[model samples]
Each structure stands twice: as C-alpha cells, then as structure tokens.
Target: MFPIWIHTKEEVKRLLILGAGGFGHMIQETARLLGYEEVVFLDDAVKGADVIGKCCDYKAFLNEYDTAVAALGDSGMRLYWTEKLMEAGYQVPAIIHPSAVVSPSAVIGNGSFIMQSAIVNTNTVVEHGVLVNSGAVVDHDSRVGCGAHIGLGSVVKANCVIPSRKKVEEGEVIFSTRRKIDGVTSRNLEDALYAFGFGLQCSYVKPFGEGHINETYAVYMPTEEGDEFAYILQRVNNNVFKDPAGVMENIFGVTEYLRNVIREEGGDPDRETLSCIKTKNGCTYFEDNEGQPWRCYNYISNSVCYQLVEDPEQFYQSGNSFGHFLKQLGNYPASSLKETIPDFHNTVKRFENLEKALKRDIKNRAITCRPEIAFALDRKQDCKVLVEQQENGTLPLRVTHNDTKLNNILFDAETGKGLCIIDLDTIMPGLAANDFGDSIRFGAATAEEDERDLDKMHFDISLYELYVKGYLEATKDVLTPEEVESLPWGARLMTFECGIRFLTDYLEGDTYFKTAYPEHNLVRARTQFRLVDEMEQQFAKMQEIVREYA
Candidate 1:
C-alpha cells in the first residue's frame, strides 16, 4: 500500500491549491464548501483567483503551512507535485465531497479527490493523486491507479484496471476490464490523416475496435450524392509488426485476389473481403510524420463483428469462412507473400525463444510463475513434431491467416452468415493445420482466455466437433492428404505454442501483448497450457474426428 495521510479539518490550518487552471478553481470551490476559510493557489502564470505564490515559491510556502493538496488535472505533473509535497513533510490528505457516496470498504490514496455525486464502490482502491470526478462511478474491486482520472459521468465497470497517468474521458464507457492501450485525441485525427496523404474532408472520427494490436478509428466521409461512407483508419503497432510494408503487401494481395474470386462467384466483392484504400501515391500503406505506418480500409457497413462466440452456429460459420478462404487462395502462390512474422507457427522456435527468455529472466517475473514455467519445460519435445514434419516435405505450406480466431470473421447481421474476413495483417505462408488449430484453440474453449478459475476452463470437445465439421465440409476437396492428416497435431501444437509465447512475454516484461495487470500474461499462459493438457488426453479422439469429417 502507498503511504498516505488522513487528517481532520482542525488539523489543517490552510490549504494550498497547486494549479491555477479551470480544475484549480473547482478545487478552490470544493475547499470553500468544506468550510476551509483559507485557500490559495500556487501557479507560475495565469494568476487570477487567489493566486498567492508560484511553484518556485512552494518551498517558502511549505515552511509556513504544513497542509496542502494538489489541484492539478494533468496526471504526470500531479505525480511530480505529490512526491515533492510528500518529501517536504506536508500532509496531503484525500479530499472527498460530503455528497459523494464512498464505500467504507473503499480505499483512497493521499491527495486524491472524490467529487460530488461520485461513487467509489466496495473494495475499489483509488490511488495517490487520483480524481473521481462528479457522477463518475469506480465499480467494485477496480483499481484506479495513481494519478489517473475518472472523468465526469464516465462509467468504469467492475474489476477494470486503469493504469497510472491514464484518463477516462467524460461520458466514455469502457466495457473491457483489460487495460487500454494508447488512445488518439480529436486534435490528432486530422494530422494523422494528412500524414497518410488523405486530403478528403472527414465528417467524423472516433475510436473503432477493441483490438489490442492497433489504434483503430472509424472515419466517415460524405459522398457527393449525399450518401455517407465509412472507412477503417488504423495506426499499426510497429513493435509487433516489424515489417509494415510486407504486412500491407500481404493484405493487398490477398484482398485483391479475394475481391476477384468473390466477383467470379457472383458474390458482392466489397462485402466479402476487406478492400484496401491505397494511399494517394498508390502505395499499399502510408508513413506518418512520426514514421509510424497507417492504413485504411472500406468499412463493411451494416455488418456485425463479434469478439466472442455467443452461438455455436456462428462459430461453425466462421470455420467455413476461414476454410473457404484457404480454398480460394489455394492456387494464389503462397510463396509470393512475404512472411510478416517469421516462424509464426514454428513451435520449436517458439520454445527456443521461451528458453532464452527464461535464461535471461530480465524482469525477475519468472520466480513467481514456477509452475507455469515447469509446465512449459516438461512439454518441450511436444513442440518439435510439427516442425520436423514440415521440414521433411510432409506438410505443405499454404497461405494461412495465422490468426483464425472467430472474431476475425464478420457475420452478416441479418443472415447470420460469415460475410467477410478482416484483420489481414498476419496473413502468411504456413500449414493449413495452423489455421484449423488456432480456431479450436480459442473457439472451442469452455471459458474465456483469462478466466481465473482453472475448474471452469476446459476443452469443449463438442465445439471442436462443430468447427471440424464445418471446416472439412468446405475444404475436403481442396486440402491435400498430408494437410488432412496434420489437423489434429495442429490443434495441439498451436495451443502449446500460444502458451509458451505468453510465458515468454511474461518473462520478458510483457513487451508484446497488452496486459491489464502484472499477472495477466501469466493467467493467459495458464489457460492455454490447461487446454494443451486436455488436448493431449483427447489426442486420439481429435484425430479420429478429423478422419471422420474427412
């Protein structure tokens, strides 16, 4: 727990507001309402309301007054002042409005504020220098980290983890308890577009998807015919995707070929696959001023994209969509596309990486997750089966959507059929079994990937059967004999591979995936390992089912 000070009104002689902004005035009003007769501001500039001293004069001011509170809103500067004030032997107590309904069980850090009508629910911890603005609710068991702000009227749902220095905008709703990645502001939207040579006047731009990889936005453009069209604007994460050009080239090639294939089959080409909107210079993607890569795609309006498999039928349709995708690209020369992520499905290489991460133990996180580390090490030989076969000219390479999770396929809202496959950045040359296995690894799970209860997490054989049936029905003729035989191994290897990758990332200080908390990656790794263990017990049955479908 962070060091904090709690004081009664009598103990505080006079309060000092650290800022002179709009929020500083609000803080002054709040102090006045609380019966503080002496309140003054310390600001370098913009001296208007009770401006007594500058930040440089804080040392002299602190010598006279022992009680003060930071009134600034910017989280970084709030933290700077909080440390400085604490070091100066000043009492910085949490300020709570009388109207705010804070639970007795809730914990508030020093210099924090719970504004009027704000509710800090049971067991929620509001950390140092934080702000729970008016009418905002920090739900049960959540942690509002130090210097973070819960904006007015914003709803932070249960168990949500807001990191330090992050801001929740007013009236914004965050559904996922998973910590958010970087966010884009309305001010940066136009400059981001202009960086991509997109000169068209956009009607609106807002955050789009819940994907952890990229910063996505939906851009709206009004047509000359008075009809409006929307496009997906994304700033790809350069950390994960090292080769943006190669990634876009893979997407453009696959989507361009998919468009032609859809047209030949009398389907709506635009609705069937993601259509890339090339830059003004005819490049596959644009380079922003910050040297980050940006790309745009025509949004499939009126279509629905699901993050989870709510219905088994929808999951089955997703299998067909991806399997048919493989069938369509069966003849598209997989070798032509560059490997955006090298050794993406090479289980052997993944384990090697995990071993290196363990050896280095850079973050010292490996000591706590000994069980998970042992589980991965025990199954090291299991990772080699698929790689050995691929090297020996057994399993042939195909253009695989390396990420074949159900959510990647967008379903028609009315028809409930898989209409389009989006997020083509990971499209690469790999075994068909990789695509098949990844679907089962995620979609066939009995519980969520991050479920804490190990008992609730299991391999749902019924869901696996459904996907295999749908997939085989679509690609029975197109897939070769070797690829058909490798389906069961694919499921096992993909699950194991994903488990080790998570463990490796955890050991390496979580540089790759976005984690809500410190143990998030470990929880994910444990779930994947659980599924892998269950698949091992049912290995024969999985192969038998694949043969039955074949």
Candidate 2:
C-alpha cells in the first residue's frame, strides 16, 4: 500500500508519503529502494482509496507535515496537496522513484515527483514541482516547466517544453511545434503561450478530481490587471491535429448528443453548460498563424457539463460509457471483427518490416544499427520478434483497450466496482485476452515493474485471483468458455506480445519505448521475458485457478 507516502511528508525530518495508489506507493518504495530509508507513509484515508495495496490507516492522520510528493492520481489533486504542503513550508522533495531510469545527465529540481516506470532521457531539464507520473516517458532533451504534471502512461517524444503548473496527461504525446514564418520558422504560438507568464496557475478542481490537460487559458480582451481564469491550451503536434478541429468535431458530436439526451429526458435544456464560440475559425479549432497548426477550446464559464459523473473514478468510466453509447447508435450495423493485419498473430511481418527498413535506411536505423554501433542482436530483433500466424479466415474486429492498467478501469470511487474502461485511442479489432492479460500484469506484480531487485518482484497470485474474480464477474456472461479458458494464456500471450514489442524495438534501435539508459529497452525485454517464463511455468496452475474462478 502507499503507506510509503509517510516518507514524503516534511513534518518528520525524514519523508512521510500520503497516498497508497500504485503510483504513490511506487514513489514511496522507490525512495527506500533508491537509498532513502527514513521514509514513512502517512496513509489514512476515509475509504479504500487510501488502502491501495497493503497500506492501511486507522484514524485520519493530520498534516503535521510539510513538503509532500503530491503524488495523487489526478493532476488537480496533486496541485491541491502541493499547495497545502508548500503553504506549511514542508520541503517537498523532488523524487525520481529509484527505478524510473532517469538519465544521469538529466537535471531534476525540488518538489518534483517522478513516479514509477517513467523514462526521462538525456539532457531533459525538469524545473521545480514537476510530476513525471507513471509510465510517462519524456524523450531526449525535453524541458518541463515548474509544476507541470505529466500524466500516466503518456508519451512526450523528442524535444518539447511543458509550461509551469500545466498538466499534460495520460496517453498523449507532445512534440515541438514550429511554423515556417517567412521561411524562417517562427516561434510556435502554443509553445509561446504555454511559456507565457511563468506565474500562471492552471489546474482546477473537477467533480471527479482534477482536470488533466492544461492546454488552454481563459483571458479577456486585455484587462487592467491582467486578471484571468484557468483554461486549457490545445496541444499542437505533427501526428495529431494542432488546430483542435478534429478534437472539437468529435467532442461537439458527443456533447451535442448528451445535451439532446438531457433535454429529451426532461432535464433543463437551459442547463446545457458549454457554449461553442466561433473565434476566427482557427482561434478556437482551426487557425493558421506561425504556419504551425494551432487551435484551442476555451472553457465557457458556468454553463452545463456535457457528461455527468459523481467522482474521479466515474471520470475514467467515460470510456466504457462511450462503448455502450456507441452500441446505442445502432443506425450503423456493427461490422464483422477483422484484424488490421491478416492472420494478425503473424510476427513474421515484423521481420519483413525490419528487413525492408534497414534496406531503405529509414530514419535512425543506420545510426542505431550501424555495425559500428553496439546493442544486443544488432537491433535486428525489433522486427525479428514477429510470428507468422497461418491464415485462419478473417479475425473478428472489436474495440479493445490497447493500454490496460488498473487506473484505466473507471471504478466507482464509493463501491470500488469497475464501471468502465478509459483511454480507448488504441482500440482496435483485437482479442479480449490482450486487455484481460494486461490488467493482470499491471496489478498483480509484487514489486513495481521497474523494480531493481528482480527477486522481490513477481506476480501476486492473490491479486491475480481478485482481478479474475472482478473481471469475470462483469464479463462472464458474454465471454466464451474458450475465451475464459484462455485467460491464463492471455497473460503469457500478452507478455510475449509485449516482449515482441520490446524486442521489436530492440531491433529497431530502441526507438519505441523511451529508455533512460543504454540497455533500458533490453532490460525491459528481460523483465517481460522473465515474466513470460514465470507464466509458462505456472501455466497449468494458473489455468486451473481461472477454471475455479470461472
């Protein structure tokens, strides 16, 4: 449990961590693992949210503390506690969980908390009070402004700067934006805006917790005192639309539906909260300045919420609710399941791609795979990990959770019952096994996945049991026996699936998973491959356990 948080608290000359969420706990444990042994967790919460893992607190503990990690799940929540701790003058330590694999050359500042599995690569400079959260990777040479909370599992590739107190959240990637101004690329507006006024406070409290993205800002047509409220600055990137047009389109559609639904259900149509203001087509969604794609969606104050939810956990449930909502749109008949790739299990394609890429000298292949360069397998294994599954008719295509982890499941904050899943961008026609297996891998591991003492870390069968019970409880009626039977295999298969990905990356010269060290991806592959071996050894027993649960 996050009892480790006791260590981050400032009241004690040592540390006192507060939360027990896996990310929080990892930070606590990481401090100890990284040689900060005086750490203690002050984990006393009103509910089970306080008892993530083994941590439990009887009576509510007081903040006779200063300088907390502010490692709470929500970026907004982190800011809340951080303000409290700072007001009390408790020195919030800038902690990179010992296992985060930060580049030695990287500079981390005070009050920063780098949670588990984060990868901060070479020359990346992090200012004070940054939150480099779980599974989030800041690629080579990135800069994070003060109090920027990088969210769970998000990817920030290459070079970029996250502004002060901004929260760049889960599952998104950021890259620098440069528009060729007069053939001389001008400074990007979004980047310039984010870098504006270092004292800006952006994160605001939300019903479910705190809002994640700080991609916009609210301002008037020039105030006497420059007074303003919080706003989100839409992220501008090459792969993703900088002008939030695509984003606005889909969101507008969803919210419009929500509004109509509320009105038809006899709810206050006047209560409809959001106002779509047209500011120079590009000002809000599509505009061309700097020749760079820049767009934004400023929050209209005190309108109506498009979606309704009770708490933070409910916020994540939007993913599942979206699924059901999609089903309701029966106007479009559900298409048959089909893999994007034929015989989707085919790993052989990996080799083909790798071979061809090398032949074509794609990007960094030459530098990463040069005979002069050094890495195991000479970086050829990236594509070599694929398999050639026999043609087996067309495989069914169904929406899937490409990245499955516990927090990804939107649980009822009150009941702790998982209501829906979130972060569906990677959804594709894939096997249920992927999601089911990943859920197990994420939660059941004894030591954090990034843990150094490999021996102390392994899958926790009890957690695995709980995951299966809960997962099956929700999905059993619709899942087939074969699918259920394959649950154990699912874990191993997913491990191999990831091992292949890691290995594939290894062959590709470590381009996919950001590495903090020379052999970071290799180490990741070893960890996953070892887990796969462990899964294989216990395959029969695991299957039996699944059978019992089923």
Report per-prediction Cα RMSD to one decimal: 20.2, 27.1
Off by over 4 Å in 1: 1-188, 195-200, 222-229
| Model 2 ranges off by over 4 Å | 1-395, 410-420
Model 2: how far residue 466 lies from native, Å:
1.5
How far is 237's C-alpha from truth in model 2 (Å)? Answer: 6.5
lDDT agreement with native, every candidate: 0.85, 0.51
Query: In model 1, which residue pairs have backbone atoms overlapping below 3 Å?
Result: none
lDDT of 2 by residue, 1-550 (tens): 0011212323234465656666667676766765654555544452343232222321233344333555565555555565555555566667766557688778776657877788998988877657888789998767887668888899887667787778786788887633222211223443434343211222221122222222223432234565344333333342323334444543444445545754665654333323333343234443435543433334433322212233333323332333333332222222332222233333345435545545555445345534322232343343222121113422222344445655544444444434433332233345555567766665565554445566865765656666666566555665567667756766766665555555556556665555566655545655665576677677777888778867
Q: Which candidate is the best by lDDT?
A: 1
When summed lDDT is taken over every stretch of 10 residues in candidate 1, the lowest stretch is 178-187
